[model samples]
Target: MYPQRDVRVRHARDLAFSLLTPEDAFELLAFEIAERAWFEQHIEARREQFYTPHGMSQHIIECLALNAQGRMSPLLIRHKGVIIGRANLHDIDQNSARVGYRLAENACGQGIAHKALNHLMKEARCIYGLDTLTATVSVDNKASQRVLEKAKFTVVDKLPTYSQVVDQRLGCVVYQCALREKVECP
Candidate 1:
């Protein structure tokens, strides 16, 4: 099981990262609504229900359940107490996890993603006992690629057709970060 306490990391005077809880449903829904178009530009289209409060609440519940199973850690990006984005360490295994993140349109180009990711990497290694992390970014998403690079993840592969995002099959770059000399999975 995961720790009950929230994971918090402060990057600057205004930007912070915190573990998202079920109570954050409304705020997260608001952020998702506001940034829907912006996020869709980079990733796959979200289900229509995901924009609703009920759907968001259900999603939060699922995230919490995953955390309980030691399979995921979903976090919110907050700027001056306002929810602005989300980051997740998902598909967790014994010694590794996959990372994904998204920022509000207004929060872009402010170094928030890079800082948040760097902090999450530390927490994943030290607190969660994960020894390696991986992330996949669309080739066209230079911003996200840069964020992964800034967090010291090395490019490991390139897929000409990685996955479908909306109607297109997007090419992607796979990145990995090794956190420790050895990983022991219980």
Candidate 2:
């Protein structure tokens, strides 16, 4: 059972990122289609900074397979059974967890990212046994920075000229969230 099974944050507010099941593959396929055009037009060029659509979709499938094998616990954010986005707890250490997410371009400006972050934070604390959450974001993505801030992540440091995906010495902002506080699971 999920550790946060008994704890549902009201702020989830119609947004949810429950565990992804094998049956959700078709759902994910649908989401891929829905977000394809936007991703191609807006996010594709920055393939080095972010995963390509094909790569992301394959990663999703792999995560699902891992989950089924009891190797990971990944969640997919959806509305009314239609997948919209995803936030995952990967690269987990004894005390920290690496988190990442992507939303369909049309899903931006909605509370989806915020809610997903909140949900992951809660799960990290209650289920994943984590103390801190870390996120590495490309320097140019103001929108991601905003989402991290809204989720109460603080800018911890800036690493200069890192990552091959970024062609020109783009700095990376490291953000973190502490789960020791009384966080409301969203």
Candidate 3:
């Protein structure tokens, strides 16, 4: 399990992931607003309330609560001190967790996500004692698939209409990373 405190991980010169907190609500809101259109095309549709600062503050509070319970690790992805997007390890179960990430439109194709995910995987093993990490990507999101593949995740399953994005149901491809033998766990 993670320690009873926030963790900030820096993967490269300008890329890092910091544990989310209530104080980050405004920056999160700004990131959401900037990436809303780009992200809506891939992930499930977010509620209108999620676009507001008040709603995001509540969301951050809930995430922190989950973090306290060792059920989730909500992190804000930053590039040179600006919140670029989010990277989360949620649905944490014994020795396993689900990972997901979103980057600003301008940050795409820069190998940032790959480095960030690699760092997260290391943290998952060392901090959370997680041996397995899973991620689900929309079938149409080939870029994300590439990122996962580059991070050593293998395609393990496919789901028909796994989630609803906007008005359409999108198929998903599930990827799994087995790190039990790759990392030393406490």
* lDDT for position 116 in model 2: 78
Model 3 bad stretches (over 4 Å): 1-12, 184-186
Whole-model Cα lDDT of every candidate shown, in order = 0.81, 0.69, 0.83
Q: Tell me, by TM-score, which candidate is best.
A: 3
How much is the lDDT of residue 21 in candidate 3? 79
Q: Which wins on lDDT, candidate 1 or candidate 3?
A: 3
lDDT of 1 by residue, 22-43 (tens): 8888767777776777788889
Q: State in Å the error of residue 172, model 3.
A: 0.3
Residue 58, model 1: Cα distance from true site in angstroms: 1.0
Model 3, C-alpha of 104: deviation from truth (Å): 0.6
**lDDT for position 177 in model 1:** 91
Off by over 4 Å in 2: 1-13, 40-61, 65-71, 163-169, 182-186
lDDT of 3 by residue, 1-186 (tens): 111212233444677689997788777787787678878987886899988878888899899999999999998888777877688899998889999988877777777788778877988998998989999999999998998998789999999999999899999999999987666655
How do all models score by TM-score?
Answer: 0.87, 0.72, 0.89
List, residue by residue over 1-186, the lDDT tens digit for candidate 2: 111111122233566678876566555655655565555442323333123445556666788776665446688886654566777888776787888877766567767777778778888888767889988887877888998988888999998865444234566899998888636544
- How high a TM-score does candidate 2 get? 0.72
Model 3 C-alpha lDDT versus the unseen true structure: 0.83
lDDT of 2 at 101: 79
Q: Worst ten-residue run, lDDT, model 2? A: 1-10
